[model samples]
Target: MISGLDDVIAAETMLSDVDGLNGRLVIAGHSLDDLAGRTSYEAMLALLLGEFLQADTAAITRNLAAARREVHAYVEGIDAAILALSPIEALRAMIARLPDGEDRDTAYRLLAAPAVFTPALLRMQQGLPVIAPSETLGHAADMLAMLLGTVPAEEQAKALDTYLVTVSDHGLNASTFAARVVASTRAGLTSAILAALSALKGPLHGGAPGPVLDMLDSVGTPERAEAVLAAELARGERLMGFGHRIYRVRDPRADALKAALQQLAKAGAVPAGRLALAEAVEGAALVLLRQKKPDRALETNVEFYTALLLEALGLPREAFTCVFAAGRVGGWIGHAREQIDHGRLIRPQSKYIGPLAA
Candidate 1:
């Protein structure tokens, strides 16, 4: 038996392909290169959800924008203590509060949760008023506006869009699989999404980006990248952003986000020096990783540049995982619906080895 069920073929999907060997990702039949660089988060959401929900793009966009507003009323009614929970916990609570209806409108409402709940919780943590989502703004733009209490600049907004698109979906990741498992029980969309959020909160799944920023803070200068990485390597700690379980080569999403950061730098949205510092650290990490583990290729992965781009976008490190949930909820919903339509319960058998006394 494979430990942790490695190489287990649990389910077949069409939502996204994580081509780890080739370091590529395809979403809904489009290459990551093609989709992430140009697609709006709404467009991708419409595309992914349309297959299962039978809703047109216009309807999806309208319903999602409306849902963003609806979630605010939901957010407003929550107890302040509940809002004080950690980002993922707060998101799970707010989602549990949404009415349970297994339909397209509920799907839209579920998709809007992270976009609304994350920034609201962050603002509450800062003792600032929670900014409401603009029904007119796109998903990424409105999310940033709520976090910052103003309209995001065009370039900054576009960078956020790219980050969202890049992370929207990836095969049956742990979080997506959790969503599918819950949906297989014919649970409500909110229930399935809450399961996804729970899985995402685990450090192994959606928790590395914040620590990447921490590594940068500890390094403090471009010249120290090598020493810091070497020290960490010598201590036998796994580097936060360098390796991936699936990708044998570099992660394709990392390249897309790195490019987005470069674009923001070119547009004068992010400081080139910050981007350069990250690049220096990445270069040092890659070299050291290869040198130390010659048998394994622990190349740079998505969280490396995710931290950089989100930092440039001015997102708090604490909220990074929630922002990721904002992007990935679309994929979770799609997979959940697909699992439900396929009509199979996800009940896996376990090998019993605990001293049978028969």
Candidate 2:
């Protein structure tokens, strides 16, 4: 058996493809770069949910936003009490309150819940009140506006859109797999999303970005990057953001986000030397890591620059995963709907090696 179930092809999907060897990603029929800054989040959701969502685009957008507003108000009512909970815990609580059902309307509400809960959890971490959703705004833009209390500038907005789109879906990731499993059981959308969120909260899955910041902080400056990385390697510590499970080459999302970060830096939104320093650190770490572990292909993954980009966007380290959930919730809902339509329970057989019974 493959350890950790490596190279296991469990299911077929029309969602995003992760081509690890070529460092490429395709969402639906479009290349990630083609769709990143070009389409709005709602439009991308439409593309992913085509034929599966039964609702018209206008209805979907309106109902999703309305659901966000409803969840936002609900979270605000308990903001003080849940502030003591971790962001993921608060997010789970918020998701748990969504109305339960498998109807189209319930699907729309489930689709919007994570977008509302994640940002609210992040803001609550900073002692800020949750911002209500705006009917006048698109989902990604509204998320940024809510987090900052003002609309983001054009470049910032575009950057967030790109980041969100690039990560919208990947085939059978742990969280997506969990979502599909739940949906296969004919569970409601809320239950499917809660399963996905629970999987995402695991460190081995969606919890790498915050550690990227910790790595950057320990390195302190560009001059120390190589030495610190070398020492970490010597100590047998895995560099937090340098590798991925699927990507044998570099992660395509890394370049997508790095491009957005460069745009932000050019627009003077991020500090001048910050991107350069990060690039240096990444390059040095890659070279040194290759020399040290010849058998392992440790290329830079998305989390390396995801942290810098979100941090540059003024998000705290604690909020990185929550922001990830914000972008990924759309994909989760789409996948859940797809699994439900496919009409099968996802109960895979497991090989047991623990004990033998007579």
Best by TM-score: 1
**The 10-residue segment with the lowest total lDDT in model 2:** 50-59
> Which regions in candidate 2 have their CA more than 4 angstroms from the true location?
55-60
TM-score of each: 0.97, 0.94
Residue 200, candidate 2: Cα error in Å is 0.6
Model 1 lDDT on a 0 to 1 scale: 0.88
Q: Residues 1-358, candidate 1, lDDT per residue (tens digit)?
A: 7887778989888789888889989999999999877988988987788866677767777778898998788877667778668877877888888887668878888888889988888888788998988978888899999999999999888999998889899999899999999999987888999899999999999988999989988888899999998999999988889888999999999999988888888988777678777888999998998899999989989999999899888898888999999999999999999898875999999889789787
Weakest ten-residue segment in model 1 by summed lDDT: 51-60
- Superposed on all Cα atoms, model 1 deviates from the true structure by an RMSD in Å of 1.2
Give each prediction's root-mean-square deviation over alpha carbons: 1.2, 1.9
**Clashes per prediction?**
0, 0
